[model samples]
Target chain A: MSADLSIVRGKQTLGQRILGFFSRSVVNIILIVVAIFWLIPSVGLFLSSLRTVGDSSSSGWWTIFLEPTRITLENYANLLSNPTITGSFWNTIVIAVPTTILVVLIGSLAGYAFAWMEFPGRDWLLIAVIVLLAVPIQVALIPLAQMFGAIGIFGSVLGVILFHIAFGLPFAIFLMRNFFMQIPSELLEAARLDGASDLRIFFTVVLPLGLPAVASLAIFQFLWTWNDMLVALLFSNSQSQPLTVAIQSQLRQFGANIDVLSTGAFISMIIPLIVFFAFQRYFVQALLAGSQR
Target chain B: MTQTVVTPAARETGRGDADRLSRRSRRRAILIALAFLAPALVILGALVVYPIVYTLVRSLFDASGSTFVGPENYIEMFRRESTFTAIRNNVIWVIVAPVACTVLGLVFAVLMDKIRWSTAFKLIIFMPMAISMLAAGVIFRMMFQESPQLGVVNAGVVAVHDIFVDEAAYPGANIRPDSGFAKISGAIVSDDAVNDGSTVDVPLIGIRADSLPDDVVNAQTAAPARAGEITGTVWLDFVRGGGGVNGVIDSSEAGLEGIRVEAVDNAGNVVASATTDAEGRYTITDLEPGEYVIALPPSNFDQGYQGVSWLGEAFITGVIILSYVWIWAGFAMIMIASGLSAIDRSLQEAARMDGANEWQVFRRITAPLLSPVIVVVFVTLIINVLKIFDLVYVIPPGVSKPAANVIAVEMWTVSFGGGNDQGLGSALALLLLLLVLPSMIINVRRFREERSR
Candidate 1:
């Protein structure tokens, strides 16, 4: 990539050219080294999962290249059959899917309300949601858990999903509201002018335009729920533990199990990876969504 | 012509407003908003607000789990030497981790700009972040595991010694058989005393122990561990041994006559922990350690009894800031970088034409312009960090370290872990809310400012 750089100057002086050449080479080398440094641990993890237990235990993962003939898939095979891990993976999906759907669903509706609906105390409600944004999840866990217990959702996947949705909605609504508000008032005015209801204007003109924000929200909420363990652990019973909780349980009291732990970690990574890649563009926007200009 | 068009238009608009039921509709809109917002508001209020209030109330109580001893708990918490240690450690964690991560992340992002495989690199660094905190804890535990070189890190150490140290000196390089953090020299003895002044036999556990030849074991005699020489890093070895598959060589086996385990909470005050079982496992409950969450009670009517657990509620208060920072800083950095990159090339060119140097151009032109982005980043980071949870809960084991803990994890521990002290948890949670609510206010003000602009 550095080799394809566009030169800064059309006609460079002698000293300038010399400095540029040295600077570029040094910068390129540093960048390459950094990229490798940043990536090595995760790559090492991937490779460790792929290799046989014996190989992983004996040498540094870097040493595997020297003994290319020793690679095996036994660890992955064992991971697949591991009942706890597989169940957790399934549980994670059940939790993440619903949580994402609800956050997006409720958030968009609330977004619509804040954007178009001319209600008294509308600004106050939006502020309240914004205020609610800072209610640390930790603070809510106990009471929320107790609430779930009373409602018969404690130790259930639904309970976990509901908790995630509740926490996720404030930010989700903020994101979606901003996006919806960006639509020119004239557009909605036009729709209403043609005898369309507010609901129809929302479903037709606004939602289509809010796709970018919605897509980003879905990606974030999905990843957040998918990766969440604290809520799941607190809310879900052992039978319904998410992949993170399950993976944590697989952590042997003594030390990490290379075979099981790596496989479990990789399994957890699969969905997040898929989500990120599938919505790569949205990922960028979502990363910057909540910040002010 | 103008009057005819204007009069009809006015009437039509008024008719439209009346048909839509302006006054009645306004009331209806309020009702609809209340209905729509009721679920989230009620839930947040119940779960978040109540617990924080409960925790504050509970912190005033005596350890017997009853009695309101106003400011006594806080006084006692501060009086303990260990409390000071915990506070220091937490301060270190807060100062070190975030700043380090942010700076490192910024540097990486800058270097990664326009690089090949930048996305791939980012995923790898971020991979640790995606894994559960509990999982990361376990992974680090494994890496730091001590054994007969059974843990990856120790194994590497042993390998390095095998290559560098003479074979005679490397008798049992893999096995750090001593308990605590010290090495004691004695003859390896089986069943009784071996007064040998030279070789010591330590029956090492873990895989590395398996490699020790029987001859070495027979030749070596066990020795008493020397005092005063044990160091902190060596203590890490003992801690590592405690968790690894390889059992730590018991202090008794080393002929240490008496050993007592004294545990301290983050406040550094000694707290009673459950005695270790025959298998050496100890479970400590009500250890107000680590991060926690604070929330209101589940239902509005039940707010009479706020919920707060000592450890659970308190931990939540500590972590609220940290978790928020981790989540929002990524965007802050990205936006900050983008804003920097977006400056017009012509501006820099114009500066250069005026004989200004690059540094001056950046300081004068770039930074001032980027102020808006920086302010945005700061506000966003403050709000986000205030709400942080998972990272705090997942990183530290609250049982051993309390002071270093955050509010979120503490709340969880207090609420769910054996301490069902919901009232105190609620109080602490409310404290967290107090900290976080200001950010929301700032955000709203900013939103209004932008809208007006």
Candidate 2:
């Protein structure tokens, strides 16, 4: 895309080029200023995480610029050593992994069915999925909480994972179904005519063809479950809380120990950020797909 | 015609067999589809659909979910002040946060197109979308602390404030006991009025020596007043080593600079006023000979400008919304930026080639074209803010929780955050659903329309 723009720019005459340069520079300056404005809070969090407790409370994070030696790894070390912090981090992995796997697995199967297979009330069920996409999780929270309690999975990581999967499926199925709709029916029909069973055709043809959608869906589900707070907060108990819930618990404590808070928040943030940037293409593609839908 | 004449019985038999076989396969396909859909359908039914129905049913029940009390929870929710506050704040959140985010997003998206480092700029702007609301709440809470020393925002605010207006010079300054000064309505006034030619001494205490401004000079005694002029020295009476005499300037004492000293007449009007210098010396020249009470007005002892109480009851909701916008604006930006990229650039170029200015091009050609995407972003945000929970639940301090409450947080509080009233919580949840339903319907319809197209 940018290559095309540069090629277009090369054709401009000198006067037009100069005028464009000035306008672009003005835009550049504005963007830089806004970018810095956007970066301040995260920078503050990162810088504070490197500072000592007393230093964080006594001065703003920007003060570290004046005193370079104030930065330390003590906060991260302390946080890593804490059982609750490490435990919650592990719990996040436990919850997010299963939720992502189950959502993708179940959602793809259902999506394939909704997209290609013949069934009674197929259109009606698809419409139900569309409507379910609009259902806020709040409507289900209380009853689910009770249901979890009754089923003895309440406050367990399994419960949180289950809840995530349940809520995640609607969107997952919706996204996967939409993506699958674009797959040429001839491919599926050819596999079926070759004596491939329905499941075999799905695995042999549809799943392979739908890899991009699958990748994006997986990344989206992983990030959603990882960054989730409300579901984890309500569904999980102290032992099962994710990093988000853990950090929130710390936030509620008096005096808001910045060293711990920043460290925990940064820790909670870095993983998803790593995942996002590592899979940046898939992530953005998924976001655009999700929004366009 | 002769060839087909005797084939009716054979054709009927063959047609029946094909029909029966087709029916069997159709039934098999139905079974297969259901088999594939079973897991998702069961989970969705059990976790999503059933729970929604159960919540609706549970809302009518009492706290224990046993006894029926229809409409009572809804009535009680309306009656409660906190519920009203929650609803009001939710309305404010819905109205303000989304528009703020969308407008900012649109601006960033449009401007970003002209820049060279657009990707980096978009990354920074959209980075917050990756952060959890809990983390965002923590960051914002720390960022908006009241003290300039701690919070970067208040530090900037205080710096800007001091540039425009002078801070109180001698905040928390107080007169010594038995110093011939009386505390009158927060001001330190001389008990005895002085003639024009008389010199006065106003010795104050209560300021820590270390807290004084760095440029403060040692205390100095005032010179004798000449006729038609009054002179005075206002200095800290407390010495560093505690050896100074009460109400007397000591060599070790520091001057209270910039203290506004007013001389009031018997009729209570300020006759003359002067500010103390670095040496705590002030001279009221051209004063009348009549008796006048010298006063250190309360403004001198006023606590200097502390930055805004962002987490206080008055501003908590706004602060929460701001934090929300901070987190979600990037989502809006990225979405809108994608939309902006998808727009037909030729239309914009043609508009520009015409006599249209940039603003006109944007307003007429760009915006109308982008309205669908904008509405999608807007409606999505509306639905999002309606169920806003994390920042509202986390950002506000306990004292301002009520003020910052939205229906989601309120629902959580009632159900689990120590309220222990699930019925009321269920009602609030239902209310939230009802509130979100319209936007959801709009969003679903938009999705359907987009898919159809």
Task: Quote the lDDT for B164 in model 1.
Answer: 56
**Residues A20-82, candidate 2, lDDT per residue (tens digit)?**
889888888888888888899999989999999988877888989999987899999999999
Off by over 4 Å in 1: A1-8, A52-58, A291-293, B1-21, B25-87, B109-332, B378-404, B418-420
Q: Which 10 successive residues of model 1 chain A have the least lDDT summed?
A: A1-10
Fnat of all models, as shown: 0.39, 0.78
Candidate 1 per-residue lDDT over residues B73-124, each given as its tens digit? 4554445564344344445544544554455555555555535666665554
- The number of the candidate with the highest TM-score is 2
lDDT of 1: 0.57
TM-score of chain A in every predicted structure: 0.93, 0.94
Q: Each prediction's Cα lDDT score?
A: 0.57, 0.86
| Local lDDT at B365 for model 2 | 84
Poorly placed runs, candidate 2 (over 4 Å): A1-19, A291-293, B1-13, B171-198, B203-258, B262-303
